[model samples]
Target: MENNSKKIIHKGISASSGKFYGKCLKILSGEHLILQIHISEDEVHHEIEKFENTIYLTKQELESTIQKFSKELKKELVEILSSQILMLEDPIFLQNVKERIQKKLENAPLAVHNTIEEIAERLSSLGDGYLSERAVDIRDIGERIEANLVGKRSDYTFLENLKEEVILVAHVLTPSQIIHLDKNKVKAIATDTGGKTGHMAILAKNYNIPAVVGLIDITEKISEDEYIFIDADEGIIIQNPSLNEIKLFGASSKTDFGDSKFKPKKIAETRDGTRILVKANLESESDCDLALKYGADGIGLYRSESLFLEHPSNNPTEDEQFHAYKKIVEGMKNKPVIIRTFDLGADKFENEKEENPFLGKRGIRYCLQNKNWFKKQLRAILRASVYGELSLMLPMVTSIQEIIETKELLKESKDLLKSANVPYKRVKIGIMVETPAVAISPDVFTKECDFFSIGTNDLLQYTVAVDRNNSVISDLYNPYHISFFRLLVNTIQIAKKQNIPVGICGEIASDTNFTILLIGLGLREFSVSLPLVPKVKKIIQVIEISQAKKLAKEIMKLSEEEKYLEIESYLFNKHLLNNLV
Candidate 1:
């Protein structure tokens, strides 16, 4: 029953950037659900044995492959799968499922499926939008098992049939799916659902996949083998694209994307030949190597949250934290690495098991309460500082008092290390001006801190009162708001007045269109995703800092809409002239 369906095109979020042309190789898709079926105690034991055996076999078989790719792109892929395997022994998870299944009297798979159904129903029942969204995590674990059973391993070469270059269309993608994809054969990816922070998007960005996500019902409308054009710049996916549209897109793609060297090669430079600093934002130590390989001037934001993510404990030890930070610093050598202290809290790290964890325990509030955690990280950074170029950046600080307190903590950690006969180095401490209070009161912070890094991602969310993860208020999370510019201007002026440096490490700095706007706002240092350095650097190379400053002043006076429109017009005009000379 081989029915040839006409090729259809669907739209999704373009997490990665590049043109991919290939035959459709779609995988089965399903909604997120954690189901636990009824199973006898005996059956549960047998299934557990089977799961262990399967993991053992998989590990033995994949050991050589994992070792071969260690520290490379495949390293993270292997680590993620290994963590999933560890879940089989997770006492709480296994025991909870066992009890639920015993009451239902079903097999392991059925019991898991039933529990998923129950959890899904409960989530649906919850009227609290904040709590209801966490059901996705439950479903993710189940998906991992299903993926393992279905033989869709993410080793890149698994899909032998997908050898020709083409775009991948899917309902949704898991981390493994994106990790295992063969970029040589696959040109781009478009998924029907996934947030900007989802693993699929993150994986795509890491691998340089031309991805588009957050496209609703795109899979249902688009057919297999359809001629589709994904315009990532405009967030548009065109099905049955006209020849003219393809040509126009093709031209744009040629300029911005094409071939194996998809990322921009030019470094950010000033028209007068001054080199503007370009650094990469890092989530984990593994990402540090990638940043250096991409020619980042240094690291602007080394997010410390990754240290806490995979662990069961509330905080990682100072020794453990020190090793990770040390590795990143050692990897970067002479490059300046700005490490942002643990910044999780808010809605970003929601655990269903922990009631009201966001408002209850997170960020500095959580650390201040758990001084052991705070001191460990501070001590580790101090120790790592002696080994390489290091600077500390505090996250979510609302007042000068917070900055002062954090500085005292650093001094205390340094003193403790000094007393212990452990080597330590004097490191510059900085604060992230994210909240309105901090942005407005930058002068007070400048007096206490070594530098200021404006985290526009959180700033935009707080300014608009938008839960960026929520679809309802997502539109309001505009980075181009004139009010945002005013905040930047204020932060910059205050920092400059105190003879300190200011850098932007938000998504805005990475955007080529707004590179000039950032420079014009008096931001001399820019930090972005690793892959974006060359493009941002190229933009820096073309624009004169003085001209950018003039444009920034003009934009600040315009209406928010007009301000954004003017910036676009300016970039477009530059684009026409190929003025990035």
Candidate 2:
């Protein structure tokens, strides 16, 4: 801070939503402790053996961490940390270190450091900030190896104790750091690294800890015990705050997130009595409280990836997966639990390398290729189905053959269960209508699948050929693209014609602005982020479904490109929508 009297307010993107006034604790980055020294030829062989052991132990540790951590911790995020495992498995990385030890007679730790650091330095040469950040992953892997080489393992145990509450700031916040952070002590979180949808952010949200990320230099700007106020909803940080700012923040904090009155009524209905089925997208049983708090109709999309992530070595054992499914199904209180089976990257399971992993063997394709794992999950879900109204959903179904194979496998699973005299219930089968081929061809899947959940995120990405993860051309991945709406309208029309219950269960469904538009498009079932359900309910309670239909009718009429602008203008206009915002 510049002075005692002066106030400084900085803004970043909100990673988690809440408000808090506390002292900022700058969590410094871990330092690498590799010494550059050439070992005697006598010790070179020993160093080589030590290096090999470290790699095995580090990979084992990564697997153990996945098994130990709460299922609430995102399993998909393993891809981030799993990159380290890939690096370890990379022959070049291992060869570089070994050659350094053998040929250059360098110490194992020093050899590992030089090899990894050199690679990291190369990644740093790339101009892209995202790729440049790969240096951190390299360093993280190096640190793990370096620690193991020194016969010591690294951890975040030091963060468990705090004298007072603080806004925890870090140069690069890891998922492990988020897990070890004491919620009572850390009132908020700020990081120079991380995005809103990153694993750390999701964990922070689960803990209800206010967090802001992508600050670039927040750790550089603040020191330990510096009084600061964080408004994570806006991703704003106030330094050297005035008394008035504190007072204003005090009142604003109450309504900043959902307080008492903000809770939604049990049933959501439009002005003219158009009842909408409002549900939540959940990761694990841990999110049940928030879903219930927001009065969710059911668990819309229970991504089953977490359980598979738990057993990163292979697949979660059937019993392990069964317990998890049962808990979530029972947690939802028999409403409905739609579990989407392992929608993982194609590169995850196969020995084949994919230049374009997204479009390769993924989701249902991966399951079909690995039927043993698929059967394990099916049997588990079937066993848990008796616990509640459970539904099994398949991801990335471009053809009807995938569904047929799944049904055959599912029947096989039931037969095995029946042979063993194990009790189970037959669950409803659903397919994620995301592939462009199937999104507009609902008539094709109508006979095979029991229900449809339009995964707008993948649907939009595949239809427009935009990779949402790529920063470049991501702007072109518009949900309101005329063709997107056209495809969505057609999918819904065909499904409705066949009397199939369909709903939106993608990231696009979370936007409150789209609530009216979705309702207008004849989508009465909405499974959005749990926190946003209350807001969507409020929107539902105000807008007449009649007006929603009118808005949809007009949006469909705008056949030209940049039709999204016209739709946005329509929605944002105060006079047109009339308190719709």
Candidate 3:
């Protein structure tokens, strides 16, 4: 770790892709590292009272934080804090801490700490990295409560005083901690432990901050104010890099991007003159703006869950939702904005616990169960449609009956708006083809909906019976599987026969390797992340439709066992597998 010694390189998983060179700023969560304290039996009741008061105070602090950032921060960022607030108020989490205080005759802080550790341990033991990552949130809440009991602040105040930009190096950062940091002062982020789906990681991507996580001992090896080079795209961190190395890396980074030469183009077309519309999946206002900057054809999937998450205590009023949607619609001008209804479950909305949340009441089903909430969102989407071209998309539709019921409710919403004499436009309705049940028979859905957006993330998961979040079986979740390709082809063909527009808005869509294959499968529209627009567009412009079709035909003929290797070998040999992601 000497400054004058040889440059040290460490590797980890890439959470967000970008390159950054900045000084290191190490952070430690002191509140969560408190020493245990003992208490007598008589102090049990008093301890429970102390714990309750701490919880109450922590909730107030979280609410105050949410209020402070409600208007200034992106809705998704605010939601991450709101989710933490919900965790603070969770009955099971609160009740367990209290029981530990009373039954174990421990102090308030000790009881809270022990309960959190126990729950986090159990979560990690589930053998699912995604579920285990939730333990970070749990630990964050417990630390907040403990900090309140100990009369200490939950955030690291040192971050506020930093005069220069630096790459934050930490063992782990809670979502709230990341939010509390001065984003302008933090050039990038590197963490010892975190998951891609964690709130901290999500914030990094949303903010366009270069970050790498799960670097087991980065904080230990990296020192304060050390010059570090973060090549997040390759998941490498160089500590105390030499001047020659720094210059070489900087030149290489600039050449790779070619900022001056690479201009954003409007049309994405193939060599044979087939035009493919490349859109962006947006979650917040900033994301909408970034999409436009990246030359997105339109906002393909405008997730409304962030709006709900922004106001955890209550559903956003119809007027509030309308204004929110209107801003994005107006911003996009002539471009279509497909706003999806809230697609979360009770776990996020109601803060209710579920054993298997993926299969539980979620997406459109949750909206139907809570009809009033659904009506408010529908009314909002309809009211905003007049501002620009807009569409309404339903998520998690497993049956035609769900679509039928939703259409009826949409009518009710329109009627209510009509009664109010509100100026609105009729928006096209669409369904997200995520499950195999829907993908297998998309023709039935095509008959009822205006369009079909294949969500390959869930479709592949549901079709292959593998959880994408579970790192243990992540290898088993293959997008190259012949079964997945068949499903994609089937859905696209069914939609094509009906003349219904079909687009893919999933993780796979953003992948450049799959772009040619998707185009070959007759998919003319793609919705990817903002950063991926240029690369995907580049791939589309270079390939011819006929060549892609030939590749697709060759792929479809391979056996289930041979498809994976065959397609991979084909793309590799053709040099179409070059890293663009």
Candidate 4:
């Protein structure tokens, strides 16, 4: 271990944004449990029995955990655990383990371990971060099975037993392990593996836990119980910090979204008093409450996919969807709630697999193909609209014809509700500008749709023809590309000219670096994650709209490589770097 009195800082990628000061607790990986175990031919039957029992036990454990944590954790985390439970019960995985144990005369634990290794290797070799992260899930299940067979449960007992707060340092954490953590004791998390989209990362954000992931060899570098400071917003881990550094971090840690510095008036406005509607992009009812707590003007993007994904065995009924949508709409108390129809098929529904899923049947296209499911969702939205202000938005819409078809479906749904004497309010309809075709010709949509929400994440991916999840080509997925900026500017300009309400509900909307640029492009609405509402609000409250326009004009003239540097310099000169870091 290094000197505890010395100040040592390490930098890595920021997975969840926050600050924390606590002792480090290093967690060991399950790789050590992969040792070989030989068994005689006659013992193979016993081993198979043990394996089957262990599988059953693991499934029960996951189900119980899911039931226990379903309400306590975020909906997404619960769904992740549910998926793992399904994997444990998967026939293919079970058969493979059984075949290895019976044909090779191997011990159950070893057979399970080998099967997981093979599957994990194949998943990791796909070169997609989302799929690669599932490898962790496979290993987690394998470890659970092995632990059950050995009559020992290798859970986060250390976290459960902790008396004082600590920053968990580990090679990686599965979604279940992360959800099972006692947040009261685990103040923050630092992982040597995993990316921003990993299960652990999502859990950290959903639970409001500060985390810094992708810190290579973090477990090896930090000693147990050593006091450290984690600045998750900047992705910095300071080990053995000096007294002054500790004081600074402590002061900064105390400042959060709740601080008066970030709190805005009833409306979000710049220093020059340019009003910008800062709304929240939510997934569940809890998120709607969190958004209001964080001072969101309204719910901009209410992702309806969770309702379907949560119940993989069956689609949510019309009443289930109506109640779910009503809860958010009524909670907002007349605040605008834009409910986006299920953006399914692409990495969402396991049944809908494609060679190129990104460009295949997804979003609006998937909903259109499954017309009954689409109409059920529409009917629910229409029924819920009477409770409060609700708008229906379609995702991945590329053509005016798609909008026309969606309107026809809406009419049919409304007519059915009318015939049944189920009163429904007239809901406004909108479209997501996610592809180049929509962005290039915003005028076509302005006439048909009530509003436009730019999905920059998808738009960028489509514009550059790069897979954002592919690490090898991630650098090419640049948002500062001149083409993307021009498209964005053009779309915003068209919306403004047509007097159409336009907003951005993508990763870029939450980014402080692009906040000024977006404001300069005349975007008056920003729909971001719950935690980002206050930070973006603070940024909007500080910038002058006229200056932002000037900055945007200057940025528009730069080449792709120069834009990043220019923005960095501009932010530094304006002293807005503090808000970002």
Find the candidate with the highest lDDT and give its number. 4
Question: 228-320 in candidate 3: lDDT tens per residue?
Answer: 898665567877665534432331222222244655467998767889999987756545666776789999987787677545345778888
Model 4: lDDT of residue 559: 47
Residue-wise lDDT of candidate 1 within 1-581, one digit each (tens)?
31133323444544554443334555546442324444556776676554445435544544554565455554455665565555555766666556654565565555555555576568758754323333544455555544453345533345535646677777776654555566667667777766544566556766766677778777776668765676553345665443423332331332242244444444656877666789887755766657877789889998788667534464677788999999999989888999988877644444423555433455666666657668889999989998789999888787676767777787888789889999988899888888888887788777788988888877877776776444334446666577777888899988998998899887566666567767877788998766667767766765677777766666676645555555555544544333332
Worst 10 residues of 2 by lDDT: 249-258
List clash counts for every candidate, in order: 42, 0, 0, 0
Please, what are the lDDT tens digits per residue for candidate 4 over residues 1-581?
32445466687777766677888888867453555778788898888888888888888988888888777676667778888888888999899998998888778888888998999999999877678888998888777887888777577654666788789999998776777778888889999988766788778887778789889999989998877888775577987654433333332333232345455566789888889999988755645656776799999998788677545354889998999999999989889999999998756666666889889899999889888889999999999998999999999998898889999999999999999999999999999999999999999889898999999989999999998655345557777788999899889999989989999998778666567778988899999767777777887876688878877776777745565656546633445433432
**Candidate 1: segments with Cα more than 4 A from true spot:** 1-25, 29-206, 210-267, 346-361, 560-567, 571-581
Off by over 4 Å in 3: 1-264, 312-314, 349-351, 572-581
Instruction: Work out candidate 1's RMSD over C-alphas.
Output: 10.8
Off by over 4 Å in 4: 1-207, 210-262, 346-351, 560-563, 571-581
lDDT: worst 10-residue window of model 4: 248-257
Error of 3 at 106 (Å): 41
Cα lDDT, model 4, residue 388: 95
Per-candidate TM equals 0.63, 0.62, 0.61, 0.63
